[model samples]
Target chain A: MIVWLILGAAVMGFLRRVDLYDAFSEGAKEGLKSAVRIIPGLAAILTALRILQASGLMEALQRLLVPLAEALGLPGGAAPLLLIRPLSGSASLAVLEDILKRFGPDSVTGLAASAMMGSGETVLYTCAVYLSAAGIRRTRYVIPVSLAGWLAGCAVVGLFFR
Target chain B: MSAALFLMIVCGVIYAACTGRIAAVEQAVLEAGQEAARTAWRLAGGFAFFGGVIGILEKAGAVRGLVRMIRRPLRALFGRDTGQEALEAISLNLSANMLGLGNAATPMGMRAARLLSAEGGGQPSAALCLLLVINATSVQLMPTGVIALRSAAGSAMPAAILWPSLIASAASTGVGVLLCKLLERGGR
Candidate 1:
């Protein structure tokens, strides 16, 4: 997929009499800079998340969210996945696997969990990385809006599989 | 974000201290920093490759072609006049996301975010928020990763999730976009 995109862009650049080499190098320079600039923010997010996970705070948070998950029409078992989904993709995947193992894959809880996992992005991580990369400190409703969307997706999973 | 970071660390330390998991938390912090570095390295390659391709497209005037194609819908969605380059970046990112090209998507999306934020005078504009909302809502046409995982786990119907996933993501994206539009107006 990416190979084709590159080929197409190259062909277009050639046809348009553009300096592909220079353009690519110039753009890549900026891209690298952006990547480097976000390392500090990324470290902070990762450390916070890891600490939360290792300290069992995430588990405690999950326990706290169980009633809310049930209220949202998801299984209480899905609370852990829901709580961790926005913070870490790999952690959420681990939770999904646990769900599939504990509840058979075809069961309501497993199916609902899988459906939710399959549908959403890591909201908090994405927002943090993007905003930090842009040097924008104040998110200004981005977090609330993105989390709302994530919750909406989770809610739809209950309604869809029900 | 500063507040969030502060709270996360402080809460984590207190929790660890209370639970006698201080050593685990310390290890996690040290490991997390290394993991973050590794992740940044992996992402830098994607950013450079995709950014280079986009740069070539921009130079070739193909970005202009792209902007013209999606201009009307995007204009209505963003409700503002943004530059052609910015629109092109936005479309590229969204397309990459829809295609489930995550490695490609992040770099493009970040580029688009940077451009849109720059246009908004370093604040996240409505367009920027909409971009993020759409991304977070999962607009992928295919959930290949889930299907593969299901198949690996010996599921009878690994692909059964395709439609449900699509529908759920679509519903969320719709709601997200609507809220962004409403909030944009409300903010003004």
Candidate 2:
């Protein structure tokens, strides 16, 4: 499947006279430039995450969210996944994996997985990618609205899968 | 939430103040910065490559051709000019996202945004809102990220989530687009 997509893209490029080598090299250079622009924001975000982890904020967050999570029909521990989802997909996936392993895949844990599967990692990554490319400094509604969607996804999963 | 915010602020201040002495706070900040840089580099590289590819594809007419192919169905659902180049870019973004190629999707999304901006006469128009809505409620095909997680977790059926994932994404996209349309009309 990946091959087909790549081939299709290549064929399209060829037909359009887009010199593949030039495009790829130029793209790679642009990628480096984007990486530079996002470094500061990324540093701030990750630094905050580290502090949260070190201070056991995540644990406290999980504890505080247990009741709400349970009310939403999610496993009590899944609260961490909710918190993690917006910040980092990798971390959220790790938490989700742990939940699935502990509670079994067909359980409510599995249902949360299903919901998350349907969702993306919220606006953090999206904003980082797009904002960096477009050089947009202000991203007011993207984060809040995307968070709403993430919450909605979690709620739908918790409500329906239970 | 306030407490969390306070703790974060305190930590940040402390970390910032500790210039020397090899404090844990300083170390943590450094490590976090390094990690962030690594992630940023990876993501940026991915986006650049993908964005360039999308640009080349556009120059090549692949995007236009694809838009033409999908125009009918997309128009039936979106109730807009699906043949528009911006629409095609949106579709490509969504498609790449479904494949878990987020870096690839970024350029397409930006292209879409530019197209929409052009169509709206340089204003942030309803198309921007619609783009956001579509992005927020994107449909996925492979659920590659989830499959990877499931496999790492030792699931017997890593791919079992596929069907359900698709259904939920489709439902969300449908609802989100419908809401956008409703809101657009209401705002008018």
Candidate 3:
């Protein structure tokens, strides 16, 4: 990735007489601005995730969903993560950490969690925010398709595990 | 988001009170908030570094070449029916997501969303759905951050998850695009 990026920059810089330092600074500034834009939404999602988990609701939901997960052929341990992952990225990361710490990072369940986390997104969170940016409030056909893709990823993750 | 935010707070509070776990809930909320803030800080740093690199690439006009490279896949996945501006935005958006520059991807996505919504005449178009799904389930070329997490957890092969993740992401993106095409053909 670095090779390709730098090669592109080098070629383009030579041809375009680009000032690399100025461009770098400009992009860095945009990065900071984007970070600030996401903070409020991130804070709210993360805090809610904690409340759900601490209030015992998350656990109860886990127990309730475990059977469904097993019925769907996934390890029961991965059920909570599949549910939480759609809601918040940091929240899912938190769940992924707990799974790793509890099951050992090299274990099958841990591997499954890692694969799922690396593959999917904070679906509901992403859809909600992105659609809002377009000023389109109703997310018709978006959520279902997104979640379907997520489920396909989970199923494939199951397949790759020993 | 409004509904989700409302429900999360309401249900979290009521459920905690009902379960007599308000104390635990309070602590958890505080900790989660702090953790998320830390995550944001970490992401900001990552974004700053990569963003600078991208800045150089963009200013050098290399970004347009990169965008052109992915235009074929964008057309295939999004269909030829979508407009040029939206298609260009989707390609760049996917490229950012592929690099795991998600913080960068969001702002890029907003730009894409604006272009797409305008093209769709202020509604959710099938192409727009595809764009969102692709962004959400982007097949990672390098999951540097997740690999770092595995290393921190004392894994012997930190990069072991890389291939499995790619396979999973491929399956997800494949299914997402197929569904989008069908949804579009179904005339919704």
Candidate 4:
């Protein structure tokens, strides 16, 4: 995939008479800089997520949300992922890893978990970072809308997995 | 976000304390940052590689052509246009996301957000909201990472989830787009 993207871009660059090497280096520099800039926020997010998971908060919530999950047609085992997938990418991936570990990846539970991971986003995390980058506050209607979208995706996953 | 973080930490610690699982809390506090650091490095590596490719694409006018190709459908979807730069950024970001290059998509998405924010007079417009919503509910064409995870976990058919993922993601973005458009019209 990476090879195809580069080759395609390089061919396009050649056709357009652009200096591909120079452009590539420039972008790489910016990428490194962005990486540096995002570290703190990412750390905070990850740390908080780990705490949430470790504290049994997620476990408790899972129990609480199981009925809701079933009502929405999701497997009870999928409760944790369905909740977290939209909150943090890495966190949910960790949850997915755990699910795959416990349930066997080919199990119905695992497929449902994978589908949830595949479909959703790190909604709150993405908005916080992007809005912070733009120095904008008062995130109006974004969280609700995205979460609604996430629920829609979850429902679809439930339909198939069940 | 800070408040949410603070609450999670405090509540988590208290919960752990109450449940005699304080050790887990300590471990989480000590280790999560390292995990984040490692992930940041991975993301940076990807960004560096894809950024170079995207840089080449941008300078090549390829991004422009790509934007022109999608502007009609996008504008029809969002009901507005910001400008060429913003459009290019969004197109590149969306394309990268669709191609499952999330690391590449972030920088491009941020570029689009920066542009849209600048133009929105401090209050993010409906278009900007739609952008964020669409991004959050990204429609995946390929989900390589999940497949890889499934393979690693010994799934006999790792690719079985592919079509399901595509349908779910596509349906998600579709609903998200419609909700944003409705809200946008209502806001106006």
**Best model number under DockQ:** 4
User: Second chain only: TM-score per model?
Assistant: 0.89, 0.70, 0.74, 0.85
**After best superposition, candidate 4 residue A60: deviation in angstroms?**
1.5
CAPRI-style docking class of model 2 based on DockQ: acceptable
Give each model a TM-score. Answer: 0.91, 0.77, 0.83, 0.91
Write the residue-wise lDDT of candidate 4 on B11-116 in tens digits.
Answer: 8788888888888888988997888678778788888888888888889888888988999887776556578888888898888889888888888887778888
Worst 10 residues of 3 chain B by lDDT: B82-91
Q: Give per-residue CA lDDT, model 2, range B1-188, as digits (tens).
A: 22333566576455444533235455676798789778876777577767666666666777777777877766665456534766787788777877777677666776665565443432234556566656766556777767776767677887776665666566565655666666656653
Q: Across all candidates, what is each one's fraction of true contacts kept? A: 0.66, 0.32, 0.69, 0.72
Model 3: CA > 4 A from native: A1-11, A25-29, B1-3, B22-52, B79-85
Better of 2 and 4 by lDDT: 4
* Residue B112 in candidate 3, Cα distance off native in Å: 1.7
Candidate 3 local lDDT, A24-122, one digit each (tens): 888788766665555666677777777887888887887787876666556778788778877777667888888888987888877887887888888
The local distance difference test score of each candidate is 0.81, 0.63, 0.75, 0.82
Cα lDDT, model 1, residue A47: 90
**lDDT of each residue in B1-188, candidate 1, tens digit only:** 66777887899889999999999998998999899899889888877877788789888987778778888998888766877767887888888788887766777777788888876665688888888888877889998887777777777887877887788788888888888888888884
Candidate 3: residue pairs that collide: none
Which 10 successive residues of model 2 chain A have the least lDDT summed?
Answer: A132-141
**Better structure of 1 and 3 per TM-score:** 1
Task: Provide backbone clash counts, one per model.
Answer: 0, 0, 0, 0
Ranking by TM-score: 1, 4, 3, 2
The pairs that clash in candidate 1 are: none
TM-score of 1: 0.91
